[model samples]
Target: MWARRRAARQERLDRVAAEAIAEFEARVSSMLATADESHQALLELRELLARELADINGLLAPGGGMPVEMVRAQLEPGDDALAQMDRISAEFTAVRVQVIGKGAADRETLVPLLEDLGGFVEGMGELADNVFGAAEATTELRVNLQDARKDLAPLRARLQPALRAAEDELAATRGAPGWHVRQVALATLGDRLAALEEGRVWPTPEKTTVDLYQELEHELATLRDEIAQTPS
Candidate 1:
C-alpha cells in the first residue's frame, strides 16, 4: 500500500514537471519566432537602404559627374524622410533597450530557478528508483522523498504563473508598434541618406539586430538545457 501511494505521488510530480516544461518550451518557441522575425525585418531594411543609396549615387553621377552640394541640399535634416527616420530610430533604440536589457535580465533570473527545479526532480527520481527497487522501502527514504516533494511543491506552484508572466512580457515586446514603424522609417531614411551621401559607405544596422537575436537565442538554448536536464 505504501509503495503504491509513493508511486502515485511520483507520477503526479512527473506530470507537473512535464507540464511546466511543455509550457516553457512553447513560450520560448513563440518568443524565438518573434525575435527571428524582427532580425529578418531589420536585415531587409538595411539592404533596402543600401540599395537606395546605390540608386542615388547612380542618378547623381550622370555622365560621371558629381553634384555634392545639390545632394547635401536634398538631404537636409528637415526633410520628411530624415525626420521620420530619426523619430523611428529613437523609438526602436528605446524598445530594443527595454527588450534586450530589462527583458533579458528578467528572464535570466528564471534560468537558475528552473535549474534548481530540474535538479530537485532528478534527485527525487533517483531516490524513488533506489527506494522502490530495494528489498523493502526504507523509512528514511520515504522521509527524504516526502521532504523533497515538500520542497518542490512551492516551485511547481510558482512555475506556471511565472511562465505566464514571461509569456505576456514577450508578447508585448513582440507586438510593439515601434518594431514595424521602425522598418518603414528605416526604408525612408535609407532613401534620403543614399541621395545625400552618394558614393560614401555607411555602416549597416543589421549588426545590432543580429547581436540581439544571438543573445536571446543563447539564453533560450541555456534554458532548454536546464529543462532537458530535469528528470522525466
Candidate 2:
C-alpha cells in the first residue's frame, strides 16, 4: 500500500513540474516574439532612412543644382520619427528587463508590456510611411526632370541650325525692306536658345519643349519664306 501511495505522489509531482515547464516555455516564446517584432520594426526604419539618403545623394550628383546641404536639411527625420525610435528602444529594454527579472514567474507584467510593444510597432509602421512618402515625392520630381531633359534634346538639335540660318539671313539682307523685322525675330530665337541652354526654361508635362520647339521652327520657316519673296 505504501509503495502504491508513493507512486501516486510521484505522478502528481511529475504532472505539476510538466505544467510549470510548459508555462515557462510559453513565457519565453512570447518574449522572443516581442523581440522579433521590435527587430523587424527597426529594420524597416533603417531601410526607409537609407532610401531617403539615396535620394539626397541623387540630388547631389553631377549636373544636379540642388544644394547638398539643403537636401540634407530637408531629408532629416522629424520629431515623430525620432520619438517612435526612442519608444521602440525603450520597449525592447523593458522586454529584456522582464525576461531577466521575472524569469517566467511573473506573467502579468509582460502581458501589458507586450501590448504596449504592439502599439509601438504600429506607430513605427505609420512613421515609416510618412518618411517614405517624402522620398516618393522626390523620386517623382527626378522622373519629371529627366523627361524634360529628353524633350529638350531634339529641340536643341533643331535650334542650333535655325540660329545659324537667322544670323546668316540678317547679314545677307542688311538695309533691305523688313530687315529690322528679321533681325528682331532672330534676336528672339537667340534668347530662347540661351534660356534653354542655361536651364531657365524647364519643360513641364503641360508645356513640353517639343511643342515649343515645333512652334519656333514654324515661325522661323515663315520668316525665311517672307524674306525670300521680298525684292533685294
Candidate 3:
C-alpha cells in the first residue's frame, strides 16, 4: 500500500540522518562557544575604553551631559558586535537544521561546507583564511575591539604627551577645577596599553588591567597635579 511505502521511505531518511546530525551538532557547539568568547571580549574592551574616555572628557569638560552619560552616547561598537553575533547565531541555527537535511549521502560535495564551518569556528590555524570562505565568527567582534583600541590612541598622541607642558601654569592652583592639569585619570591606562600592544588583549587579570574603577568613584583622589600625572 502507499502508506507502507511512505513509512519505509521516512524510516530510511531517519537512519541516514543520525550520524550526520551528530557530527554537525558537534560543530555547531564549537561555533556557539567561539561566538560566546568573542562576544565577552568585545564587551570588556568597550567598557574599558569608554571608562577611560569618560575620565578624559570629564577633565576637559567640553560642556555636555555628565561625562559618564556622554560616554554611552558616543559608543556603539559594543552593540554592533552584539548584533553581528546574534545574526551569526541565527544563521548558524538555520544551517545546523538544513546542513544534512537530505542526509550526507553525497560526501564529496558536503566536504566544502564542513571545511568552511571548521574554518569559521576554529580560525583555520592560518594567518590568512581562504580567499572566498566565510570569515571566522569573531572577525567583526575583533574589529570592534580594535576600534576600541583606536579610540584610546588619541590620549597617548595628544593628551598625555601634551599634559606635562601645562603643569607649571597649574602647579599653584587649588582644588581640581582651576587646574585642568589635575584631571581625573585612569591609573590603568599604562597597563591597558601594554596589554593591547601585542595586538591581543585577553588573559589579563582584572586587577592588572582595570581594577581602578572603584578608585574612579573618588575622582578627586586621582586628580593629582600634572607633574605627578604625566606618563613616563
The lDDT for every candidate, in the order shown, is 0.42, 0.63, 0.42
lDDT comparison, 1 vs 2, better candidate: 2
- Candidate 2, 112-158: lDDT as tens digits: 76565566656656755665675465556445545655665676677
Go through the candidates in order and give the C-alpha RMSD of each one to the true structure: 35.9, 7.3, 15.5
lDDT, model 3, position 200: 32
Best-fitting candidate, scored by lDDT:
2
Question: Residue by residue across 1-232, what tens digits does model 1's lDDT show?
Answer: 9999999999999999777767766654555455445444443443444444444444444322123344435434223333343444454444434443433225575455434334433433443333233312222323432453444344434433544443443344444444344334334433433332342322234532223223333444443344334333
Model 3, residue 4: displacement in angstroms? 12
TM-score of 1: 0.32
Identify the superior model by lDDT, candidate 2 or candidate 3. Answer: 2
Q: Give the poorly placed runs of model 2, Cα more than 4 Å off.
A: 1-123, 131-148, 202-204
Better candidate by TM-score, 1 or 3: 1
- When summed lDDT is taken over every stretch of 10 residues in candidate 3, the lowest stretch is 124-133
State the displacement of the C-alpha of residue 173, model 1, in Å, after optimal TM-score superposition: 78
Global local distance difference test of model 1: 0.42
Q: Which regions of candidate 3 fall more than 4 Å away from where they truly are?
A: 1-13, 62-232
Q: Each candidate's TM vs. the true structure?
A: 0.32, 0.50, 0.28
